[model samples]
Target: MRDQDVEPFFATLQAANPSPETELEYTSVFELLAAVLLSAQATDAGVNKATRRLFPVAGTPQAILDLGLERLEESIRTIGLYRTKARNLLATCRILVDQHGGEVPRTRDALEALPGVGRKTANVVLNVAFGEATMAVDTHIFRVSNRTGLAPGKDPLEVEHKLLERVPAKYLHDAHHWLILHGRYVCVARLPQCWRCAVRAYCDYEPKTPPPGDRAG
Candidate 1:
């Protein structure tokens, strides 16, 4: 999309959903971190299902460590790659407890140092937990960024950089949530529901798909 169109595109999104948030259910920063860790290659709904069961029993870093590897694995076994994620969670908990005094780290470097935490995960924690203007580009954001001509890039990092530079400062903090929700429910991967997209007027996607059974509209 043209640089000029970027504002309205986001403006439209903001107007539709003024207060977008991550779908993953969490009551605290640590819970948010764990939920994002478990969310890899899995749906928010799926992650929530497991976390709903796990967090109440073991939400804090110390509680999780005390839960032990075997039990942690069993708790999140419903998610994909449960064993690796369990090990990573336990290891990360140890670091948080031993190094950070059981509190989630605030800096990107500190957050990334934990096991199972990568650039994307760090970005999410920084943005959502700490209110930073960071973008955690996922498959949905990648698709929406490219598909909408919003901030197209070959990789998530590139897209993230572009978005940071291009997105209006006013919308930067919440842009990530808007894009993800748009891609998830409106500009879907299979066939974009353009006919009903709130920002269709500002989008760059052409020949917008019409309502069902009316592709030529």
Candidate 2:
């Protein structure tokens, strides 16, 4: 949490995974945008499963628009809130075709204007697709930020802002990915795997969780 510890904390993460990436599968910015939109309240694995089939059939804004609402719904029905997601995707495709010339807009305002796209989704697209140093504080990032005393805040926006301010500029671009992956695999909500954490030495959390078999008898 200290000014100095922040750098090494992220350095440790970066060392472990040199190139962190979003688990959501996509080949284009448009597909990534749609995948992030559908990923709300859903797992990356689930989204990938649905998108795997959906993308091949309708990967682009125009292709998805041509797929029609009924068929789109059927294609992504395996994901949670598929009906709503389908409707939003359809509307978003229309906007992309009409306003953005079938391209995923790079600006935050334009990206957020799309149906189903929120600040978090926009941040992800901006960071991953455009290499912008933005943080998309999802449940995983939120939990990791607070639990590790990295950038404790009451809400995602606060955490995001704090992370941007606190994290060293050199690590800003990949900070979100590193923290998200760490939270997803190590600093889990139910029980953080502190025993094997790479940055455990820098973490301010008290009474770190022990290895499974090392629990007090």
Model 2 ranges off by over 4 Å? none
Candidate 1 structure, TM-score to reference: 0.97
Each prediction's RMSD over C-alphas, in Å, is 1.3, 0.8
Residue clash pairs of candidate 1: 1-149
lDDT per residue (tens digit) for residues 29-133 in model 1: 999999999999999999999999999999999999999999999999999999999999999999999999999999999999999999999999999999999
Steric clashes per prediction: 1, 0
What's the distance in Å from true for residue 37, model 2?
0.4
Each prediction's Cα lDDT score? Answer: 0.94, 0.95
Tens digits of lDDT, candidate 2, 1-217: 7778998999999999999999999999999999999999999999999999999999999999999999999999999999999999999999999999999999999999999999999999999999999999999999999988999999999999999999999999999999989999999999999999999999988899999999988
